[model samples]
Target: MNEFRIIEDLHRLQNQFASLWDPFVAAGGSVYPALNIHKGSDQVTITALVSGIDPDSLDITVSGNQLRLSGEVISGAPKSDLGANRVERFHGKFQRSLELPAEVDPEKTTAEFKNGILHLTLPIRESVKPRKIQVQSK
Candidate 1:
């Protein structure tokens, strides 16, 4: 029905307005791209929330025990909004490096960026993995 379509359109517009009003700083607006580093028995997994970034612009690298990620948010506006008065998406180069919690096998490190998210995996150095020790019940 026309009434139903009108309601749906209004809802969509309302959602867009809400997103526009929200402060970018309230979001992860940091140059670091906000990451979660997790350490496992054999690997370290790092996830970076790099939304609104161009996949082609991102660079992920691991050297020694350090992980470096850098990228830029290219200036882009919604097609329909090309004539609109204002825009909020960020633009510019951002860089951040993290000192890995422990030594990692640099050769085994790999990373992928999909839908504005970056996933990095680094294998733990063989010498750093915890070793099980036999204990005599004394």
Candidate 2:
């Protein structure tokens, strides 16, 4: 193959690999802790799995329709007498941000940490919530 043809073929292979990996990252594979978002009539609930992390180390914030979650997982140093054969769990700082589907009231938002799960409840704006309309005879 000509020099230009070789480069073009390499670029095409790179594109194919990127396309295969993009879907996994887009589906929340990159985030440290997986998240589940539930949209209700009046509120939105976000749940994250943060097992083995200290509650005090977690930080949750909401800006407009975006929610940011950040925290650090500190692993204690192994004892001098013992040596670790294998390590699998992740340790260190991680942050994940998600854009909500609708506008929410940041002031009314509430969070709870229990059983290694962080749950955030964001109340939807009253103006954007579904409402019933009445019809009148002309």
Candidate 3:
């Protein structure tokens, strides 16, 4: 009856809706994920939420202005002797890409994955950075 419960219920409903549509996706086995991108003073950081995906299966590539994330996700079999009738996790091969707002040094990009999240840091090109200008009196 509370607001939190209502939110939780809505999330569950969304999950259910996703679950229903996922079978079709599974058959095709291709996905494009929406990623969250952030920028700092000298670096651009991207965090992608990719649960149930194997770290070894992921491939990342950065081109002139684009960053790509591609991977295959396989579902784990149930461990118990009792059969599981429901599966809610999303599975399949996914390839997601994001175009950087500004040019980044592709060679300096670093990637790390932990706790089902993929983190990427791309450093900005020094040439594009701002330098403090000094005013001279005439």
Query: Would you list the rank order by lDDT, best first?
Result: 2, 1, 3
Q: After superposition, how far is residue 83 of candidate 2 from its true place, in Å?
A: 6.4
Q: Which stretches of candidate 2 lie over 4 Å from their true place?
A: 1-24, 28-30, 76-84
Residue-level lDDT of model 2, residues 1-138, one tens digit each, is 245445545554543354345443565453456678899988999889998899999988897788888898776546565555444455567766667888899999999999989999999988788888999999
Q: What digit string (tens of lDDT, one per residue) describes model 1 on residues 16-128?
A: 45434434335624334667889888899998888888787888778778877777876565556235353334445666666888889888888888888888899999997
C-alpha RMSD for every candidate = 10.4, 9.9, 9.8
lDDT of 3 by residue, 1-138 (tens): 245445545554554455446442455533344366887779888887787787889999987667778887786755675654554455556555556866789899998889988888999778776789999999
Off by over 4 Å in 1: 1-31, 78-88, 133-138
Question: Which lDDT values do the candidates have, in the order given?
Answer: 0.70, 0.75, 0.69
Locate the minimum summed-lDDT window of 10 residues in model 3.
24-33
Best by TM-score: 2
TM-score per candidate: 0.63, 0.72, 0.65
Two-way lDDT contest, 1 vs 3, winner: 1
In model 3, which regions exceed 4 Å deviation? 1-34, 77-87
